[model samples]
Target: MLQKTIHKSVACSGIGLHSGKKVRLVLRPAGENTGILFALQNGSGRRFLTPRPESVIATGLATTLGQGGDSLATVEHLMAAVRGLGIDNILVDVEGGEIPIMDGSAASFVYLLRMAGERTLSARRKVYRVTKPVEFKREGKLIRAEPCDGFHVDYTIEFPHPLIGRQSLAMQVTPQSFTAMLAKARTFGFLREVEYLRKNGLALGGSLDNAVVLDDYGVVNTEGLRFSDEFVRHKILDFVGDMAVLDAPLWGSFTVFASGHALNNAFLRHLWVNADEYLEEVSLGLEPVAGLEAEPGMVTASAAVLA
Candidate 1:
């Protein structure tokens, strides 16, 4: 498949999940081989960062990518949207330290990407294909991955709550499947936990509007669940996002059990450290690499400024 980027720029603004402060995000097309780049607007000036397994600095309530002294939190949803849509290169411009937790799901990001449109690039796409089966286990959580033609995930989440006992979802992750099956599933938390987080200065922007809050007996939101198995679906969505931290798309069949952000990042780090033994980098179409830069400019002037 050919590499892809957005056709034009798109922007959105919302409240940060942890800071509870307004933030703005801008998406712009990028040149082939740029991968996913972040332009962090901080006190000094703009700084660039590319997502990598080791770049993940935090995974408490969400995944946070950091470099130097700048960091961006709650990036999984947006990253999931980018990878799910098969986009190979793009620029993410952030005015705040955290990505906006839009509805606590990837739906808004999907919509924004669609609005920006998609443009195919001249360069072929590269992906990491798993060559050997590997498993990473921590405590009771586990993540297993093996070779696959495309990205696939079988995820199971277990909770004692009556509304969420044991839920499992398995699917081939494609644009259609991700948008219809996983994009709208919102993050969830218990009522007591939410209160505790707020008291400790966390989850400040969280509310019933963004998350599916639950009490001892049942769900606290009046609107109820988006799907009967929404919890598991959201977990799968998170898994997709976490995997996007790799330099390129990873083609594998993943079986995950009770794996959260911490476990997910740990497994990814293992894969990165043992890449030669477990991964094969394959480029599609075998196109010539010479003289490609002579083509028309792929990124716009505004995007170049951000980059």
Candidate 2:
């Protein structure tokens, strides 16, 4: 497969999930091998940032990347959109300290990226293929990964709330699957938690419009859930975004159970420490798979097995 970038520039503005302030984001086409870059605009100039596991400064409420006094917050959704769409090179311009939280899901980003369209680059795509199995566990939560030729995930989430007990989703991630099945899943939070965060001056912009808020009995949002198992689908979306910090596309079969941002980053750190033993950098030769060229808009079965 060849590397890809946007064909044109696109921009949008929305409320920040944490800052509660209006923020603008612009997506621009980048040159070959540019990878994903973030240009944080301030009064004086722009400070560039590259996402990395070690650069993760905070993962409490969201994944945050920082260097020196500069930090970006709530970046996971946009990152997920970039990776999920199979884009390897793009420039993300931000006018604030964070990307705008659009409906608390990747659906809006997906729409924007499609509007910008895709352009194939000259360079072959770089992929980090798992060569061995690795498991990271904390308390009862765990993330297990094994060798695979493509990215796939089997995710399970459990909560004690009456509306959400246990939910699971398994699928091989592809552009079609991501757009059709995962992008619309919205982030969710408990009503009591939202109240506490608001009192503490956090998540000031969060409301029913962006997130699926739930009380003791059921979903407080009038629209209810986007998917029957939206919670697990969102977890899978988050996993895709967190994995993008590796700076190369990762091809693995991952089984995750009740893992959050902190644990996900920890697992990535551990994997990086033993990268040579567990991972290998491979290049796709850009050859089309046999007997699969004529079918447009069809994701290969190997790349989109859902359960």
TM-score top scorer? 2
Candidate 2: C-alpha RMSD after superposition? 4.1
Candidate 1 residue-wise lDDT, 1-307, digit = tens: 5789999999999999999999999999999999999999988999998899999999999999999888999999999999998899999999989999989999999999999999989976778878889989989999999877578899999999999999998888878788999999999999999999999999899999889999998999999999999999999999999999987888889999999999999999999999988888887654332222212333211000011
Q: After superposition, how far is residue 188 of candidate 2 from its true place, in Å?
A: 0.4
What's the true lDDT of residue 227 in model 2?
Answer: 90
The number of the candidate with the highest lDDT is: 1
**Model 1 stretches astray by more than 4 angstroms:** 286-307
- Against the reference, the lDDT scores of all candidates come to 0.89, 0.87
Identify the runs in model 2 with alpha carbons over 4 angstroms from their true place. 288-307
For residue 97, give model 1's deviation from the true position in Å.
Answer: 0.4
> Model 1 Cα displacement at 204 (Å)?
0.7
